[model samples]
Target: MPNAAPAPGQQPAAPLLGIGQVLARLTTEFPDLTPSKLRFLEERGLVHPARTPSGYRKFSQNDLSRLKLILTMQRDCYLPLAVIKDYLADVDAGLNPPMPGAALPGGASILQTGRRLSREELTREAGATPMLVQDAFSASVITPAETYGEDSLIVLKALVELQRSGIEPRHLRGFRQAAERELGLIESALMPVARRRDPSSRVKAAELAVEIAGQLEVVRSSLIRSALSRIVP
Candidate 1:
């Protein structure tokens, strides 16, 4: 009965509950969540709970808070797993805290304001050369568009920062390959729905891909943070 809900008046100092109790609290918010899914998340290193003497996992308050943040990102932002991981890492390092838009249900921003500049304007604003832009395009890190989107502007800004570190566009070629692989996974997941060719199906597939990507990002970020923990403390 892993999915069984807890009965009323359980002991407050229990300090640990099996997977069933954890789901009882969490499933109300995350309807599609299941034991297997939670295990999948753990397998990817997104979550780590204390093990009981009998080896059953016992989640804590901190684990709940972190799960809330991870789920919020997935339900809201359509960011890729790698990007989400980088963002969570920033927050763990006390750099970028979670945005208000990320916390409220269905409050995700389109992230449109960040792209106020046109491509030409972005190049001027970022102080990046045409060659750099071309390099980014060639690497498939930024797709060709009639106009560069807000994301493109962010990439350009990132490149500017990297330039200060003596890193050039060529150094990021592997990034494009990684992006392709992730996109392939998304496409494969969407294939069944995508074949339907209905507007709703298309929208659903896009949203699902975005959420999956966000979850993957959270997992990646958590793994990196765990690696850094030994030296950080």
Candidate 2:
């Protein structure tokens, strides 16, 4: 058991908050956050709130800061929990850590942060013509969104360069299929963690899936590099 609440003369060092308040405070920036997701984060040992005498959760300011870090990495950066976990562990230990959502070495990052772009802005930034944009979208190389993201601009820019090499979106139709196949493999490998219905298991499953995908990416890149090693420009 812990010390009883201080008498009327004194308040705790900081006010403690209920789960509802935490959700309300954070939901504007993290719309997908829910009671279950908070519980999921708890189960992963990312944020530990204090327990009331009644066994209810009570979040402190530090807890809120930790949750913000976790949610920002997940939503804005699409970081897998494992990477975020390592980052947080170092931070809690009072060390400087590499930020999350960086690309695995020798690979491209799948997510980005910054201003959202309209179609025209994306095309302008990528220096791509309307016809080329249509071709990329039609090939499903980049999914359409009301407002495009940085990744969309990157893909479009690459398509522009590849176009000058006489390679077009049609030549890259297989990329999507390859991605789906790799995803299927990762999903299959995640069956053990995915079978449980608990929040902890769900979080574990997500991290495992990303780890598996990262491994597959390394292997794919190794093969590509090996194949290119023998080629001459």
Candidate 3:
């Protein structure tokens, strides 16, 4: 099928790939991916491939990159589609948004470089001892993974610094409990949206969950800052 021409005032470019071609390129990396999944992602507003004259979906190079990034985040990071959509929105607006759970540097877009480090590499890069990593794992501070992402490295590095202050992972075990409590609060708040159970409502519920989590984080940080101020003075 011939690709559609660029719209008025739009720059003409290379030919776009049909759905089968897109799948051919991506299936090796994401075997579980299928046409329905791609359509679902589009419905969720994560990626918008152009429509051909006969209404076939044709993906551009940019769309392919975006799909790769989305799939990678879901597969590797276990991030929800809603969170991924928010991150992609920031990227589309030309903002260098940090990865969903990681405070990476502005220039380090995971979309540009899908970096996955082995266990040994993660420990070495974070300058963390194996014991510390084990403790963190035991404390549920970091989930065990064969290959860790940048977020894991960031967490390990922070733990290493905290260890010097005599704050071991065991001391922060309650953090996981606190997180679960906050998650419970989110789930409770989303009950209204969740009751609908339709596709659109499901998407809305997911997005609302992210928004609620962000607000909870703000409150949590404020409380911590308030507590620290009393101790420092």
Candidate 4:
């Protein structure tokens, strides 16, 4: 496995890890991650791991850190690729710019905050009640989990605010259905690569799905804005 952080007294001349090694390091946190997904991220210039003479990928410590940040933003913040790419551009340039939709430092904040959180801890951090959390799971706003991820906290917070405005979890069921429809569209688009039983093909398929999801988010946002413009003012 790739060590995203160097061990003390580790050689400065250490060789970087291959794609499989990087996957081994990241898969526990990003279970759905694949080689294709990593390549897709590279295509968008989110993280540029080095290539060997034979064109094999090699990931460095910095590359792993950047990838961890990218996945965190996607899974936790629900950000689009464009936004994450922009954030990565800043971080790569040595800037500590504020993370969009986060109260913490850009990319660096995740170092302090680990992935897992208990249900009570989640509710308290999101400023939500126990009842609201139960309601959210019951309405299928978020899948039930023994321990919630940071994304759950973010969603719960948003639900709390919506509830105050008379927009309860039940009111957002359509959003979940729409998400499933979008996921189906992504799956259909990746069918060619996804059908291949080889490891490389499987990786490529995962990456393609993420790229399509980003474009869909842009379209979804545009439609929402267009509708709001007609209904208001």
Candidate 5:
């Protein structure tokens, strides 16, 4: 994590953020944001909203902007929190986010901003039960998130439909393996840039990993289901 900001030039200290203000600001964008979840992000080093004399957090406008960027990447891009943390690290250092677009070196567009969804909203929209969603995580099909993004909801929704046809979360455990293999490929491909330790490159590496993994999942699931169909009644 970055070092704490120098005490604002010794000027009069700014007001701290109470729970309600923090909730009110973040809730509009991250509807599932709770005090626990915010604390979790802080614990992970993703955000460092300043603390007041009473220890209440006081998020500056910059803090709010950074939070928006992080949530956008998570929900829209399906990036794991670790990767998102790396990207934000770049931003904090005044470096551009590494992703597809003219902003970074790679010509890929995979790092575009995206919308996110809350867990409850995702379950309801995807017509999935909470148990099934939890099972996905338990089976290593999906990771836990403070708020699931749209892609996650879409995947869960599709899985729910598949479950109706007798496919279980355990059946998709291979998906995790297939995904790891694809990530291995992307990592190798990006090693030249990734080895430099540039925050932008790291972000790019992460974005590429997610994009390829998503594609690999689609193909692997389709091929397996198709092959099974021939033997099944």
Candidate 6:
């Protein structure tokens, strides 16, 4: 459960860290973190650090932990801030909600433990051959990278399974085209937000893009399921 706010007329607990100290502690893990980004997260209501007498922000231990979880989810899971905010709301309410983008409840915490893998390690871990990985790259299914993250590993593993059903990476080339079309739709939807020249607007636009993509996924999955039902019946 999350820490409760102090009652009226009560001061927050001692030993809170200022924004600079918090940055010092977290910058190594999150190299892109900046004071403005921290402020942006606060503005998004992901963290509610207490205020000092002079109106400065002071983060408690709980605030620091929450920030870490939020950042980890963003970095590892690529989840939208809205989704993460909803998941954290459940946690604060004392519910054991499943992590977003995870396959199952109680599967893993939002904090990922896996490191990026080289091409060889990626194929080995996915039980796929180098040829298949190359095909995925050729088909634009997976971006060519010197080191692959968990998302690439998951895609390669799925491709390996699909291969057993005689579906090769080349057979899925249309998926890349479909993704490009969906991206076009997202970009169109974000045009108004993108027209703004402010940094916060850019942040909002990015989050909105992910949320739109998630909605598109839901529609795409439903269409697939509907099509499958006709064939299976």
lDDT of each: 0.70, 0.80, 0.83, 0.80, 0.72, 0.85
3 against 4, candidate with superior lDDT: 3
Worst 10 residues of 3 by lDDT: 103-112
Kindly list the per-residue Cα lDDT of model 6 for residues 74-178, writing each as its tens digit.
766667777689889999999998777664446754435336799999999999999999999999999998788777898999999999999999999999999
Which regions in candidate 3 have their CA more than 4 angstroms from the true location?
1-113
Output the TM-score of candidate 3: 0.54
| Tens-place lDDT digits, model 1, residues 1-233 | 46555668774444656688888888887665677766666765677889879888888877777776666665555454445565667777888555523434464354533335566787887788888878777767677776666567878889988888998888888987777788888788878988998765665565577656756676667998999998798
Q: Please report the candidate that would top lDDT against the real structure.
A: 6
TM-score of each: 0.51, 0.54, 0.54, 0.56, 0.42, 0.56
Q: Give per-residue CA lDDT, model 3, range 1-233, as digits (tens).
A: 99897899998886799989999999998776688778767866889999978999999999999999988777655576766987888888899967865524775545435778999999999999999999999999999987887778889999999999999999999999999999899999989989996875675565567546755765777899999999997
Point out the worst 10-residue segment of candidate 2 by lDDT. 106-115
- Among residues 3 or more apart in sequence or in different chains, the pairs in candidate 1 whose N, CA or C atoms overlap within 3 Å are 81-217
TM-score of 6: 0.56
Q: In candidate 5, where is summed lDDT lowest over 10 consecutive residues?
A: 100-109
Residue-wise lDDT of candidate 4 within 1-233, one digit each (tens)?
Answer: 87476578885665699999999999998887889778878876788899899999999998898899888777666566776776777877899967765756565554245467888889899898888888899889988877887668779989999989998898888888989999889988999888899975765565566668866766777899999999995
lDDT of 5 by residue, 1-233 (tens): 98567686766545556667878988876665677656656766888888878787778767777777766676556566666776777877899855522233354344444346788888889899999999998888878988776568768988998899999998999878866777678778768867878665665566555544545555667898999999894
Model 1 lDDT vs. the true structure? 0.70
Clash totals in order: 1, 0, 0, 3, 1, 0
Stretches of candidate 4 off by over 4 Å are 1-113
User: What range of 10 consecutive residues in model 6 has the weakest lDDT sum?
Assistant: 105-114
Query: Of the candidates numbered 4 and 5, which has the greater TM-score value?
Result: 4
